[model samples]
Target: MADVVRPSDRFRQGMATRRRVLGDAHVDRASGSATPFDQPFQEMITEGAWGTVWSRPGISPRERSMITIALLAALGHDEEVAMHVRATVNTGASREDITEALMHVAVYAGVPAANRAFKIAKHVFDRIDAGETGGGSHD
Candidate 1:
């Protein structure tokens, strides 16, 4: 049998990690916006995804950022792509790296997805250049 993790403990740990990777302001907004109906869903993300997968040491944040960018672009997760692009500063993935990754998305995920991703990324980059960046992650 596998050991179980307490939900409270996982939530605490996940929030810390999420704040570190995604930035405090973004985490705060998400946390603040949680309603009763959505609280459980929020806990799932805070504990499961952010706490478990993102906390694993198998991959560096930079690598995770690149992979995340590619997946988001490939899946047409437009809002999430912009958020992760803003998070590039923390992940150490440069705009060039994102561009290169998007090229791969074009080849494998279809050009329309990549085209939209590029457009979304451009909006994100423009915000970064203008110091108008927003949330950390939408997913």
Candidate 2:
């Protein structure tokens, strides 16, 4: 069997990344709604996705953001894609990287998914540019 990974470190690192990428307001909203049913799941994501995977030393956050954006777009996860899109600003992914990722999604994930992802990304970018609070900060 594979080694069982403890999540303490992952949780801490993931929380930092989550806070940096998603901002305190978004994190607060997520934590605020944490119920008995979802708390465990939330922790799992924090430790596993944010902490372990995202905290790995292999790639820079910018590279990870690009890959994440492409994957989310391809998977038709528009909301997640949008969130990550906003995260690109902090990761230094630039608008060009996102455009290329969406283009790849259009080719591989289907135009519909790419279209929706683009729309959501645009909206998020607009909100960010407008300096809306609660949308999270990159740094």
Candidate 3:
């Protein structure tokens, strides 16, 4: 039999923050798809990344969004970069902000990484423009 774990206070906060940033639809899909093997991993990120880091007050969500995109690009995490790019609609990071972050990534992380990230960002931007992503573009 499987054991049910009660959510911690931090986990609940993280879930709220995650939903705010990623949207209810995305969160629902992810939660619905979680299997036993990956459930623990999901919980960990919810509590650690969203609850702890993202919930902190030092930086705004917009700044965190830019930093997340840049770091994902630098690490060549293509899917994550695209996901975060789409997330900008909620984070309030404008297209210009993402572009500037990528520019920095080019100089600091490497041109190749930045170039790939740009392509991914552009695709996400196109979707945003088409009104397929729900949230309006920040421009």
Candidate 4:
């Protein structure tokens, strides 16, 4: 017989944090679609990204959201940038805050990367303003 696996304390914390930041619908979609192949990846993010980094108290979720957006933008992670931008609703980050972060990204990362990120962010913001809560994956 296969033994059932209980989630760890860290995983629990991560799941809670993830849900709070990403929302129930997005988290539900991600959790529901997890296959055996990507299950470990999902677990790793829950335990690492959400549980460890995001759960830390030194910074606010708003700060983390801005930093995440900047990093994703700098790295040319278009989809992730949009996803995080959408998540700003729950993270308490304002559009002005995101614009400031992207401005920094332009100076530090590059014009091209920041420009593309700005376009993506604008599109997401437009959708959000239109009363549509869906922009990125499962959002």
Candidate 5:
């Protein structure tokens, strides 16, 4: 008989962590779109990144939020930048924190990237104020 595969505790932990950081609705959309082709890749990130790395101690979610925002902005990952900005609400990062991080991006990464990050962040905060989920459109 073939051995059956099961989810590891780390995967479960990652799922919980992902849900906490990304929110249930966002995670649910990702989960609902899972296919056989991407299942393994999804599981890998769930366990390795979310479960193992993000769930680690030392840095607070606040610190991680600042770091994540800067990295995402530096890389020009506009959508992820906005998403992480929304996560700041849970992470206790203020709008000032995000602005400061983007300032770092401007000096270290580039002005264009920081400019776009600022624009994206403003759109996200606006949507949030309009009572919308900071979900949708990574483009």
Candidate 6:
């Protein structure tokens, strides 16, 4: 069985990391939608992914961000990829790092996935360049 995280600790840590990475507005919106049905899943992710894995000592956040981007891109999870792209800055993953990861994804995952990931990344980067809170563009 996986080591379960305490609910209180998970919520606190997850909310903190989420706010740091995704910004307060995004975390607020997500928190606002918490319902009985989805709350458990949210907690699980908060504890397991955000608190446990992300907070682990094995790898730097930048490396984790790179791995996350690659996995999300390869899986064609556009929304998640976009979210992580926004997290790159907070994780200390430069635009160049993201570009390199996507290029590797292009070779291993497929050009289509890489292309779509690039487009999403570009959109996020553009938003950043435009002084928007969570958007950025590569091109």
Q: Score residue 10 of candidate 6 by CA lDDT.
A: 62
Q: Summarize candidate 3's per-residue lDDT along 23-111 as a digit string, tens digits.
A: 88778777777898888888998999899999999999999999999999999998889888998889999999999999999999999
TM-score of each: 0.89, 0.85, 0.92, 0.96, 0.91, 0.85
Error of 3 at 20 (Å): 0.4
The TM-score obtained by model 1 is 0.89
Per-candidate local distance difference test: 0.84, 0.80, 0.89, 0.91, 0.86, 0.81
Candidate 4 lDDT (Cα, whole model)? 0.91
lDDT order of candidates, top first = 4, 3, 5, 1, 6, 2
Clashes of each: 0, 0, 0, 0, 0, 12
Off by over 4 Å in 1: 1-7, 135-138
Q: Which scores greater on TM-score, model 1 or model 4?
A: 4
Give one digit per residue, the lDDT tens place, for model 2 in 1-139. 8999576866889999887767677788887788988889889888888887888898888889988988988887766787788777778898888888889889987999888888888888889899964543221
lDDT by residue (1-139, candidate 4, tens digit) is 9999999999999999999998888888888888998889899999999999999999999999999999999999898899999899999999999999999999999999999999999999899898887535632
The candidate maximizing lDDT is: 4
Q: Could you give candidate 6's per-residue lDDT for residues 18-90 as a string of tens digits?
A: 6776677676767677798887877777777777777778788898899999999999988889888988878
Error of 3 at 53 (Å): 0.6
Better of 4 and 6 by TM-score: 4
Q: Which has the higher lDDT value, candidate number 1 or candidate number 2?
A: 1
Q: State candidate 3's TM-score.
A: 0.92
Q: Residue 45 in model 2: shift from native, Å?
A: 0.2
lDDT, candidate 3, at 10: 97
Candidate with the larger TM-score of 1 and 5: 5
Candidate 3 global lDDT? 0.89
Residue pairs with backbone overlap in model 5: none
**Span of 10 residues, lowest total lDDT, candidate 1:** 130-139
